[model samples]
Target: MIATDTLDTPAAVGSSAPAATPALPRGLAGTPDDKEMLRSAVELTRDIATARPEVYWPDMLLSAGLGYAALAGAILIGNPVLAALSGVVSALALYRALLFIHELTHIHKNALPGFRFGWNLLVGIPMLTPSLMYEGVHTLHHARTRYGTAEDPEYLPLALMKPWSLPLFALVALLLPIGLLIRSAVLVPLGAVIPPLRRLVWERASALSINPEFRRRPPEGEFARMVFWQELGASAWALFVMWWSATHSWRPLLIGIAVISLTALLNQIRTLVAHLWENEGEAMTVTGQYLDSVNVPPPALLAPLWAPVGLRYHALHHLLPSMPYHSLAEAHRRIVRHLGVDSTYQKGNYSGLLPLVGRLARSTMLPR
Candidate 1:
């Protein structure tokens, strides 16, 4: 979750704020205000493509359906070989849908009341996670995550290694992907059993920053409810798949379950790549939001598959959570216009890596 201090700063269109300095792979800098970003995206969208309302709606639906069908068919056939194939197709589609989920959250709705709810229900159930919570938490992360000591939970967890420990550190970082699977499949679920453990879960669910510097006075009951809603939603989807697998055949059901879990796991890794190592000990002020956000365009092959849903122009989304996801790339383009290329990552190349390689390199986050 993005803590209050993590998100309290701001970056404006022309303001010379000292944004988060780039230390990672992407060309991340500056935490500009949402309006400035929105304006930029609007201008850029005019040049790239029409930024129409629901522009990517059809594409999202078609891909999701295709992915869903592929997964289901593969499972129904009861061939392990087919299941693997379907998993790939489904994983790709699900990934793209995730970006849209981000985009959809940024959408402003007035006329499409049922459409909004239905959309959430459909996507939420299948994905086994609530998009709304991620939207909120992600906004905070983008706003204030870059400026912290080991104190920030989003950054380092404190306790740096001595020179002797470098080998161990490197070893663990190399297993990032494997560690991620372990964390998700085992750690997260196991941790929930204890009180302190549960509170952390609650904090994450509510998007509360655990770091005292970034802590906000949130509504007490809200986070627990979010925890219930989000987890139950995902678990319920799993149960539904279990039942479906039992009836029509276990193959598709098991495959769906695996694909869904793996996809979410992969998404978590993507989130990690955006900002796993950047922070400052500086005292945070309202203007501090500028130093936390970063931007990168994934490889072209990955973008069409993932950007429409919201992963492509992510830095802008962090700076301006209110801007819809579909418009992020454009919004980023706009910010780049005034801020120069340094404001964004121009590369359209996917960073090819497995989860294991990522963990070994940066355990703070899962692999992208």
Candidate 2:
């Protein structure tokens, strides 16, 4: 089970007098007043924070259905025009289904047991992105001490890095399918038999991480069981894909791979603008972590398409990591409506993804 500890820091929308940064963990500190204010704001929105089992089931089922139907129609139907139309739809639906993994990491275990198992069976195993890869790694990204640091497995300060790194960052997702396949088909089996190799795989190969130096510890207890089952499913899927391609026809598997690649590419773009990337591995104040994060608020209709699963309000998420996905917009609305324009919360809102990316590019290229 995931840790359900309440963060001591408050996640409020209103601004108050600046207080001295209170002592905190090695990499994070923030004013107690700030924490308290946020807590008050959060309490106001607490009713909506509970997960809705009803919403998750239909959404996953429909997206998975659309993705599979479109893919099958595209591959089996011989018409070029119909195939093109279906292919585009297939890519988007598949992307949405895969995106649900982000939500899986945050959802309360008791809330959606069947969805978790179904997700692993449908999108996770076939796409080579099992929940095990993200279960432990993603939580660290929200840790007050690790948000912008090298230790945060999911983080890398993209804007602060060399300009060349940006293109490499976006383009690298195209190679992920191959990499994931290698991890499942080659490394997983080998590591199970070899003791030394098992350590290396657990630490270096298991996580879905952006930080090159970050390493994960092997899971114990229930998490270890999760890893075992998920890895078995993914390995079996990978083997099936290989056998299917060799025996049947490559058309369907190729189309599925294309959709998965497209999903990764789209996710990579979302990750690019997720943060300002201003902190250079510093243990930041809680407020500092809030400032570095981004929220592409409404009027950007496309924002949800690219950063769905409640990711559009990313900064708010940093403030209240335990809040359920469906409730985030209501939490954001409640915070902003009550706090007004002058609030520190306003600092997290950006106009759109392109503007955020443009600002980061300019920040990196132009003299400060």
Candidate 3:
């Protein structure tokens, strides 16, 4: 449940007044764990913990295949209206495929066999967002001691920020395709020769993170080897795309960027509601983290479109991070049935996207 207690900081009533950083309300300062809820979550969903290779392979391949096919239609078709529709389809499909990176992070290296390689080849490298960008980085966001804190790369206190930050957050995603293009095509290649530049890129520009202060440490051992290959593949693909655009018409490349830009916009909007963003750089209890996160469950039919691959149940995800995407729905149903409507579990459930966004916006407007 969201804490109803209010922040006590002085109000920033005028533009001239500097806004003080917001704090988590006293009621939420050190919320105790809901042990019953945590135990039940584990016990109820144990059967569905295994990642199914069959489901993962077909779904990812199909999504990537459809995305590329629609992208081709969008670029080649002369009709403006049809091309626009194709672009939308391509964006949505590719977005879903790209999100499989989340699954890649949680699943064991051996769980899905060559699934990681397949994904990087088909979707990740092509998009210039290889798994290396997320693999080691995202797990920190799930760490019990790091979540919602300054150490968490994927977290920020957005609800405690100025009102304009919300729109700015989503708007920045529109430039992601261009930013990624430069990173892979120019930065990665240049960084290969300049050790300092490579180190800087790895620390600052590698992760898909919201917290500007979080810097990724150097990769080591097996993961370091993985990063090297993934970076090489992404850089090569980016350079090839640049060469193709220079030799051929620029229409295809430009259209592809536009489609990816739409995908990034959709992802950024989804990120806005992924959490309440109320924690003030403090480590949260499991229950606090669950409440801070969100779940847009059944009957809100459009959620799957915006939060695909079981992301609609994001709060539940924090509870069972290792649970495969295909199994989250059933796990949600079982947990909800066991815990009932009034449980802390249900507090994470929300109606739809707009209400959550409005709630975050209103929180930002509260006295700083």
Candidate 4:
């Protein structure tokens, strides 16, 4: 223990791994009490699934209720702005639900075809906005949260970018749009040109159970392919919706496109903000759980909305995806106590965002 403490001291930074963290850190969110929280969360999830798994019936009903109220506001008072705003919020909700699907994607829950259909039909449509190709890359991010030379699809290597280079930062912001467009428009369709992607997904899904290779040692050239497939799926979905509203004219269609685009921008900005403190080549830690994800503190009503996609209680999400979001806070509490470390939560310290920005500006000069 004394040796571990000495090595963990700052003087040993460049020499070797901290003695306290022999093989990276363990029990990040799965702290001493994690087993208890997991047990409780699992019991609840099982009940929910047994009674109503498919369609997330309870949640769908709630969304529908919200939608109905929004619809009433739209048609009764002819308040397009209010209606549009509600649609925007609902759209985000739907997107989060799709993210929930991602939580289940690797779990091998194929036994519940009904739940699959529900999530796909409800959440799938909105998720169409983000290319699945991009999403498939997420598997890589989860597989290998640490920095490596191989570019993980979810690799947003901004942590090490020059802190003073606003121009470079701006370039990244600019590419967000281009990347979205190309992924939606070009890459997706081109994927069909090659028949190997399905095999890749199958490979990834299988590997999720054991190898953890998808994220750690990313597959060659698959990231590009993932973006391509997403483009194809999103374009087709977008066209379908536009056609449905065709008689409503291209104006609303254009407006919808604009709205989704703006939302994407917001999403991108949020993602960048999360990893502000991440140093390239640093091992993934509990802090990265929320630092690499969106944070939401308690007392926020919208926390529930964020939780479905695994962004809510980020600490637990990192440690155990199977632990439903509802139990994340308690799990995090226990883990922090056991590990004697602090990780980012949904809401962060006031200064967290600012230092990140300043550091980001000067990051490129940093030693990797």
Q: Give one digit per residue, the lDDT tens place, for model 1 in 136-234.
A: 444444344343443443443222223333244333333333333333344446666766655564455333233434442233475456546655655
In order, the Cα lDDT scores of the candidates are: 0.48, 0.80, 0.93, 0.44
Q: What tens digits encode model 3's per-residue C-alpha lDDT throughout 1-368?
A: 34545465775666676676555544343566789999999999899999999899999999999999999999989999999999999999999999999999999999988999999999999999999999999999999999998999999899899999999999999999999999999999999999999999999999999999998999999999999999999999999999999998888999999999999999999999999988887678898888889999988989999999999999999999999999999999999999999998898999999999999999999998
Q: Provide the TM-score for each candidate, comma-separated.
A: 0.57, 0.88, 0.93, 0.56
Q: Candidate 2 vs candidate 3: which has greater TM-score?
A: 3
* Candidate 2 lDDT by residue in tens digits, 154-230: 88867667777888899889788888988888888788799898789889988888998998887999988888999
Report the C-alpha lDDT of model 4 over 156-223, residue by residue, as the tens digit: 45555555444443444433333444443444445456556544443452121211344323334854
Ranking by TM-score: 3, 2, 1, 4
Q: lDDT of candidate 3?
A: 0.93
Q: What lDDT does model 4 reach?
A: 0.44
* lDDT score at residue 86, model 1, on the 0-100 scale: 74
Best by lDDT: 3
Candidate 2 deviates by what RMSD?
Answer: 7.7
The residue ranges of model 4 lying beyond 4 angstroms of the native Cα positions read: 1-57, 60-84, 110-113, 126-136, 144-149, 163-236, 242-248, 282-296, 299-310, 336-368
Roughly what TM-score does model 4 have, to 2 decimal places? 0.56
After TM-score superposition, the amount by which residue 343's alpha carbon in candidate 2 deviates from its true location, in angstroms, is: 0.9
